[model samples]
Target: MDILLSICAFILAILGIAGCIVPVLPGTLLSYGGLLCSYFASYSQMSTSALWIWLAVCIAVSLADYFLPAWMTRRFGGSRAGSIGATIGIFVGFFAGPVGIILGPFVGAVIGELVNDRSDFAKALVVGFGSFLSFFVGTGIKLIVAVGILVHVVADIWVHVVADIWPAFWNWLTNLF
Candidate 1:
């Protein structure tokens, strides 16, 4: 049971890391899930306080991810069209790979702004840039939280599993020599 939980935790941690840039996945929440799995494992040394703290951070980051893009768009004078376009771009970009993912929101925002107000190319560009910046900021924060959770899970595994087994494995190796 412990091993199974540990494996699940590792898989979740990896997925959480990928989710940070993928946009469709809830990276921080997935990471928090991983931490929870690890916490439940008998070998885990994680404290209840740490789990609660991580849960708070995950929720906060998730909320920020949802709102940051819209806030940035509005801050840069973008409208609902721009935000909608950015969202569409994210889904569309998913098929185009990394470069597309990176540029999709900006292009979408620009196109949306242009569609909304063709007379103001400069404003559209500003809105597009704002959306682009928001992507980076949001992704950066999510990545940080996800990575932190991964680190914690890994440390727990190392301390409990690897460290415990290392001495025995070393002895076996020495006897075989």
Candidate 2:
């Protein structure tokens, strides 16, 4: 049962990493969930304070994820419409794969800008560039945080298993390879 929980948690961690790029999944949160699972499996071994800290970070990052793109849009002189369009584009881009994910926000921003002001193509382009940059930046941030959480979880699990069950750890490692 313990091994099964660990396996499921590891899978969730991998999914969280994938989610960072994919956008449809709550990458950081899901990754954190994996840690939570691992914690449950070894409740007495895991540090409660450490878990709380991770949860706090995850929540903060998730909240920031929502605002960064829009904030970035406005920072680059994009109108509210452009921000909204970029948000929508993120959802649409999910269906189209990586290239589409990169382009969707940019194109959407441009279109939104154009719709807002037909006379300023140059400004629209600028806003589109801002939106594009923001998307990539946001994705990078999510990837970093999710991976960090996954690493922490893995390390925590490693400490528990290696310290408490060294023989089992060595046996498992040998078998895994």
Candidate 3:
């Protein structure tokens, strides 16, 4: 049961990291789930304080991922249309691979701004840049959190499982020789 939980935790942590870039999954939340799994595992040495702290960080990062781009678009003088377009572009861009993921927000914001008001291409570009910048910031934060959780899980597993097994395995190997 402990091994199963640890495996689940590891898988969730990995998915969380991927989710940070994919935009479709809840990256930090998934990481939090991983942390929870570890906490419940008998072999985990994760403290309660650590769990609470990670929970808060996960929620904050998740919320930020949703709102940051729109907030940035507005900050850069973009309208609601630009924000909406950027959100839509994320889903559409997912099908186009990495390049699309990187450019989707900017292009979407620009297109939306142009559609909303064709009089200012320059403004549209600025708004697009803002969305692009937000994507990087949000992804960075999510990645950091996800990776941190993954590391924590891995460390716990190593300490509780591998460290215990290594000595016995070494002895067995020596005996065989």
Candidate 4:
């Protein structure tokens, strides 16, 4: 029973982590759910309160993940055209899949800036690069929080498995490395 439950928890955590890069997945939130699972899976020294706080952090990261790029870009003097371009890029990237999603915003921002700024390459590049940097920052935040939540899950699960005198199995295996 414990093995099955732990497996389920691991799957959720993996999905959550994937969500961070793919943008199509609810990575941070799913990570929180996995942590919740491990925390409640069995009798152990799980810190429920700590996991709760961590979940809040994950939620904040996820929310910021979507908004931070535009917010930072706007703050850095990105034009309205740049902002619209980033939005369109995000959705269009969804259609092109992962690689598309990754590069879509930068391309979109450049094009939008060019159209709005009347062929000014330097200005468009500025907005495009600023948006790209902000996006990386956002991605870093989500990855950090998601990993933290998953770590908590592992720690919580470790306690139960150890107490049960079962060997701790790294379910992530070759996938993690």
The candidate that achieves the highest TM-score relative to the unseen native structure: 3
Candidates arranged by TM-score, highest first: 3, 2, 1, 4
lDDT of each: 0.86, 0.82, 0.87, 0.76
Q: What TM-score fits each model? A: 0.86, 0.86, 0.87, 0.84
Off by over 4 Å in 1: 164-177
By lDDT, the better pick of 1 and 4 is 1
Clashing pairs in model 4?
16-27
Candidate 1 structure quality by residue, lDDT tens digits, 1-177: 776777789889989999999877888888888899999988778899999999999999988887887678888999999888877776787788998889888888888888889999999999999989998999999999999999999998876657655566678899999
Model 2 Cα lDDT, one tens digit per residue, 1-177: 676667667888889998887777889888988888888885336688988998898888888887876777788999999898777777787788888888888888888888899899999899989989988888888888888878877876776556655677688899999
In model 1, the worst 10-residue window by lDDT is: 160-169
Candidate 4 lDDT score at position 71: 71
1-177: candidate 4 lDDT, tens digit per residue: 666667767788888888888877888988887877776666546776887688678878877877876775576577888887876777787789777777778777877787788768887888878777766787788888878777877776866666553543554554567
On TM-score, the stronger of 2 and 3 is 3
Global Cα RMSD, each model? 3.1, 3.0, 3.1, 4.9
The global Cα lDDT (0 to 1) of model 1 is 0.86
Q: Which regions of candidate 3 fall more than 4 Å away from where they truly are?
A: 165-177
Candidate 4 clash figure, as a count: 1
Q: How close is candidate 3 to the true structure, as a TM-score?
A: 0.87
Which regions of candidate 4 fall more than 4 Å away from where they truly are? 162-177
User: Which wins on lDDT, candidate 3 or candidate 4?
Assistant: 3
